[model samples]
Target chain A: MKTSYHKLKNFINTPFGVILLVAAVVFGVEVLVMEFLFVFVPVIQASVPPIAFNFLDAVILTLAVSPALYFLIYQRIHADAEKLRKITESAQDAIIVMDNHGRVSFWNEAAETIFGYTKTEAIGKELHKLIAPEKSLNAFNHNFKGFQETGEGPILESVREVMALRKGGEEFPAELAVSALPINGTWHSVGIVRDITARKKRENLLRERERELTEVNEYLRNKEAKEQALLASLGEGMISTEIGGEIITINRVAEEMLGWKEAELVGKKLIEAIPAISETGNIIPPENRVCLNVTAGACVGPLTDDTSAFVKKNGESVPVAITTTPVIIGGKCSGAVIIFRDITNEKELEKTRRDLLSLASHQLRTPLSGTKWLIETLQREIHGTLTEKQGEYLTQIYKINERMTNLVHDMLGVLRMEGDINPAKIEPVSIQTLFGVITETLGNVAKEKNITLEISKTAESSIDTDSLLLRNILECLISNAINYSNEGGAVLVETKRDGADIVFSVKDSGIGIPADEQRQIFQRFYRATNAKTFDTKGTGLGLYIAATLAKKIGAKLTFESAEDAGTTFFLRLPASAK
Target chain B: MNHVLIVEDEDFLVRALKDNLVSEGHSVAVAMDGEAVFDELKKKKPNLILLDLLLPKKNGFDVLKEIRQSPEWQLIPVVILSNLGEDSEIKKALELGANDYFVKSQHPIQEVIEKVREYLEGKGSTKVGL
Candidate 1:
């Protein structure tokens, strides 16, 4: 019906409908004039008296013409409506038309699909009642009434996302655009709607991704700031460079250490800016530079090559110990960091200390030795036979001198042990000859104590060691054994060959080291709590010196003891190949 | 009787040692320096040498080296007695063929007498000091 009506509407709208209406009106008026003339002629007044009384024919003609004119007008109006329907049907939006009475006058194919109401069922129903949400129905009714009265509505021609109901009674977001169209001197509304649920979901996902990206970017910024702060706050000189050895950053300590400002050193090659100079005043080559080695994925320790110094900007050299590490990421060296400490003052202090120690040993011992010899000469009764009282005083003097000598001697030994000693003079030493010397030195003391001192050598092979150092160690251990043991307690000194090592052990039947104080026995100046009550003269440096000396000579000292029983100390030296 | 040479610069120490050695029935000669030791050696070969390390003009180590330079004097045993009793110095003296070492103040005069007697007894033993 719509297709047929549109064809006729197009024909009338052009020229056919205009000409047909004009011709019908003109023909009706001409017929009326002819009939009036025929009825009003004088010569036929009497003959046509029945004709003048033919008003029924005129009334019948008027009724038939009026009904025909109304049919023509209705057909033309239907044709115009079909043309508007065609425009609305092809649009993507659901086009809904409602008349002045606020009832649904037209629901296009899109409107039927969007709202789930057929055109037949939707027509004559209020438009807002069909699709408006219950929450918005009151507002919609007020706006619709205003629209009908003034041809104005709040949403007219305004596109917005609105909650819309579908035919399945489900609600979804939609984009609605509304406008008023006038026809027959009354206003109708055309509402264009589009489903926007899919668009809204896409927009939401995009917003979430944007937020995540911003958070990640912010976190990275904060981490970078924290790293920068840490690098700037370090106490040791720190220099960082790109993988190519170009200087990228230098901390405040590095600037002060090198005597170059950060701005002056940045972008310069690390090796070029701060040269690694040897103490002998030679510039080191690049391949030998510690930072470059780190950049090449090498883990290099403190580079004190030739007592290395880092030459500063003003041509002064500062002795330093440099250590470099690579900043590795994914198995690649992205950069390198070098940390160095200035040791000039420390080195100077160390040298001064060594000098003072050497002086003390040489100068102080000379006079002390002279005093001891002079006192010993008197005690030998070379001056005369002394009275008992004089003899006792002389003996006291002798003991005091002896104690002083031992203290000075042990103090000097500690100095030497702590400092560098020349490597032990390794030589062939016979255990038989060695023990002979030890026994000869310690036997009288052992005899006085009534402690049987025993010696046994089980190894047939000759042992190699620094004989003097070995003698000192054995002397300390044997003397300690004698000193700590009760009268009549025996001391056993033995030597044997363990696999790859020669084990020399000193076992004593004496007061054992207190369990709690055992670990601290090797520390300098540490005395066992038990020793304080024994009235024995102990330097408290015996075991410390013994242990350190043993270590220097590549030996291990291990001991075992039980309280009130006895203690055994073992010195294990590497069995040397002849 | 053993003839002993006391090569030392200290007169009191020399006099005391000489008195002790004389009482012990050994003839003792005095050399105050390394040069004096050479002069004394030329005058009469001693049976034993008691060498002091820190002597005037020339030390005992040089005197000992000079004495060891000749086979005639090298056979004579020398005992080094000194206040410099550090292991390095002691090892050095022993390495240069001194018979034995004793610290001057560490031991009493009796111990010194004992060490001198041992060397005096082995005057011509000819065993190398090392």
Candidate 2:
């Protein structure tokens, strides 16, 4: 029951309930007066006519209810007006009211704070002229004319963003919403304005970041395209794999070489996608694969394995020279890149060259040998006797034949060295015995030059090496020493041990190599200018063959030379030859 | 004097070798081609055979193989005198039962004669002029 009474009291506080209550009170008063007159004032009611008595009752009802109704309705309206004023005063937005004359009628505290003006200074002032930017006044005035006449305009009753001027003459962005109000038959506008500077700054920052992101995205896309073009332009077949040996990318050449499409090979393990076979026709396992070793970081540098063949998709094998390099990023192995080329044509060409070299060697040496034998027969006087002059002529002919033979031998040696024929046959070669044989072979040549060949054998230990190659190298060095030495000059063939390695030094007191030409001393057909002047018969291939043979035997050949002083050629053989 | 057989195709080289052998007091017999070697061996068992690799009818390797296959010629010392100086060719010739190998240009005729004389004297096999 108490809750119902409270609900009724709350409803009576509304404007519609107040009106209904007033009407009920007024009716009650009218009824009570009419009943009182009919009951207690019967003489007056009987003396007057019925219609006139009704009129008198109506007058009394109006007189008693008019003051009470007026007082209650007026007090309620006054309190509501005061509540509205308080709400507008405390609002965060600037609440502004303008009269129809375009003057500011009321301004809230927010307006004072926003426009840098007190309410007293803002009121009664032309609102547009006071707060609108100077450049915006013309448009404001134009819109205000229509707003004043119809109390309606495009800017009225709708929110808009506008440039607002502060009292200090600074400008800022603002949101303005205006609604029309009419009081005393004149139009007025109440506007709510909010400052939007901070919001505008945040929006601009977001736009700038978006533009930067777009530019970076465009740059990356172009860079990726350029890299694709470069990869496609390579002549050799290329494959890239992740660190785990999974194929990441394969180029067009690689696709054609393997007979596998890029899509089919990508994301597959390298060893599975393309199987490598050894020369013995055995499949190379994953542990021995070059690309996998590189990707797994087990290989330190670029490795080239040319003795293996890769089986194509069609099950045909192609011999290839594959070079695998690890991709290192930030000191870590990230992936691997394998570059390969089909060496079938190269292998065939090499075989053809070897055949040609062999044929040439046989053909050229046959005639040379025939000449040598005929000259030797004449010199030996096997068929008949010869005069001293005829013997001298035959000896000259024999010497020329011998030179031609040596030239052919040197040429063939150079070709064989380049062709990489005949793997080394390793054996224990005594240093003393090797030097003895080389010095004996070159003894006649030293005798021709009247040069003394001295042997200083300090190293008696035998080294494991290819005996033939070691003998050839030592013979060339000794002969070169004798050939370049002046008459009576000494040629010392010395040998000693230097920390597990045997060093053979051929020191010659001869016309040493020129300083500038020493760098190219080992080059094929390259003779020092001074040596060429001294000996016209030198083939210049001796040292080149020696150097190549040294490399083949895993030895190091170096020399020290000074002009006219002497040259010492050093051959350092490792204890364990590769 | 022991009889020696010269199996060679080159006329000039054959003449010089025959004349030198005759001068050395050894009976000289000639087989111009590989096919005539058996014919010459049938007529007389030469003490030594100087074989030249490049021949008209059959190469020296086939001749050497056939010679080793025959019981009568198997005991004869056959020396290879070829201008093919490659190690592989030399090794092939030696592997085919050549008693000795010599690159002709690298060795003098006197050295070859000395080798033939040594073989005729019944000395054991020796590899030379490698």
Candidate 3:
């Protein structure tokens, strides 16, 4: 089972056989000389002294000399040879030696097992050809040339990571180490090899994972850059403010709209940078303003109900439409973003339209007053006599003029609502004062329709409000109730405090507004569908103007109505509104 | 006859006011600008001044402010007649101490004349030329 070079060493050295030859020669020469001398000189020994001699003496001497010397030296050499053969063949790593001609001169049993080849088949074959079939010849030729010229080549160290051929023609990764030494006056290389397939596969997998991670990091960085660019390109006047109301980022539109350069305003407070004023002429500090239309607390949507006048760099005030959304991160409100547009031109145009409407309404008053005067003058002069038909025609003309005058008055209300007037015109107006005004204004209308209108209240603080506008709003609501009421139905105006807001309600037993049309009643040019069939003259602008003024003065316009259940229109004005 | 001076830029409305005041037994003198107003006042000191807000040579507020600054015309009542009935304009006119302010659209020609009569009578202007 072992490939032993000891057998070869023994055959070549012949140590034990040479020792046996010398021992045999010395034994033969001693025995022959001793016997020749005894047989040739017997007469000389007798004359010297009559000595005793026997045949047994020569036999004992030959026995003692010949076999003893041969057995002791030759047998010991054979025993030491056996031990050397076993040690050389039993190593764990594959060991093979190649002669100077690239042929395998020595192949141990371990080498045969490692290569899946028997020792007999491996020995005497070219070592490179057995391990690497295709590149073996070229590699051997190159390495042999290098060794011959430079006296050195690759030593093939232990377990090197490279492909080696199995007997089945498959290649697996292996580790190899080689050493060159002189054997019997010829140079040879002894290679020690080991398989390393599992270790190499693990290294390749680790490198691939590292590459994947690097690619993912590169992709995320690019995506974040593009998103940042998109945030910067928004067209509206975009502004981001810190929680302390300091401006952080101002977009191009915002910079132009506020008339401030980016460098001039970034760290300044919004109020300091751009002092804003309400339509009512009150200055609103930026920190107190609420963000509108924010959804899910992220503050990424449009603002609502944002009307304020921004102070320009030159101290001129320009109206703007502003929208603000809160910027929230990690479930907390961090800051807010505001978008706005300059609306000065549009506001001016709207003011002009309202001015024209006001002028037209006033124009109607002159003719109306003249006609009333003329009719009164005629009645006073002709008290003595008049035909029934003539009186009826006069009465009809009187009624028509009255209607035209009322329409003109409604138009005037709308015009006045459009004007920019501070509602700080409010003063400590008593509920009694409100009652006196409303009843007096509606007195004539109620008389014609034979309806009773009145007011009731139970409030201590004289409700601070613009008496004139409040009178107009209440009169509209009460008169509408009276006009739309059946004959003999009652109308009542009442006021009281409902928490922080003053509650003013007008209740009337009348043709109530339909439920579905209630939402649209406060809209401009919106008339109730049921009211259209009642032959009542309503300009539809009265309630619209009333509601608008109510809102401007911080009042809520609400109502409850049911068919034939009577209607109640309530105005909840905050105490601060006063 | 009670004398009323009408300082207005609108020719038709000025003429109509003049004719109406003249027919009602009042002497009417008209000026179209601030310069003309002073010239007319030199000829005959009017009992009342009805000044329009808009004029060619000067605006009504400026004329009023100038007339008010003068010691000679200090006692004369100047009523502002304007088509710009804005709240701020009205406030400014009142603050300037005009006797009254009226929008042209708010009154008829006859009613405006009647208002002038009521104002002049309330002042008790009995002296003829002064």
Top candidate on TM-score is 2
Which residue pairs collide in model 1, if any? A157-A178
DockQ, candidate no. 1: 0.26
Task: Give residue A524's lDDT in candidate 1 (0 to 100).
Answer: 92
lDDT for A324 (candidate 1): 79
- Cα deviation of A214 in candidate 3 (Å)? 4.9
**Candidate 2 lDDT by residue in tens digits, B70-126:** 988897999988998887888888888898887899888888888888888888566
Assess candidate 3 and give its lDDT: 0.70
The DockQ ranking, best first, is 2, 1, 3
Per-residue lDDT over A469-542 for candidate 2, one digit per residue giving the tens place of the 0 to 100 score: 98999889998988898999999988887887888899998999899988899998898999878977788899
DockQ: the better of candidates 1 and 3: 1
- Note the residue pairs that clash in candidate 3: A156-A177, A156-A178, A157-A176, A157-A177, A159-A175, A160-A175, A160-A176, A299-A326
Q: Which stretches of model 3 miss by more than 4 angstroms?
A: A1-223, A239-340, A347-453, A462-471, A482-491, A509-536, A548-567, A576-578, B1-130
User: Which prediction has the highest lDDT against the true structure?
Assistant: 2
Q: Write the per-residue lDDT of candidate 1 for residues B1-130, one digit (tens) a residue.
A: 8889988777667766776788789988999987888888888899889998888889888878878888879978888877775566777888777887876655666777877776676543322322
Instruction: Please give the lDDT score at residue A5 for candidate 3.
Output: 61
Q: Backbone clashes per model, in order?
A: 1, 0, 8
- Whole-model lDDT values for every prediction: 0.78, 0.85, 0.70
Task: Please tell me which model should have the higher TM-score, number 1 or number 3.
Answer: 1
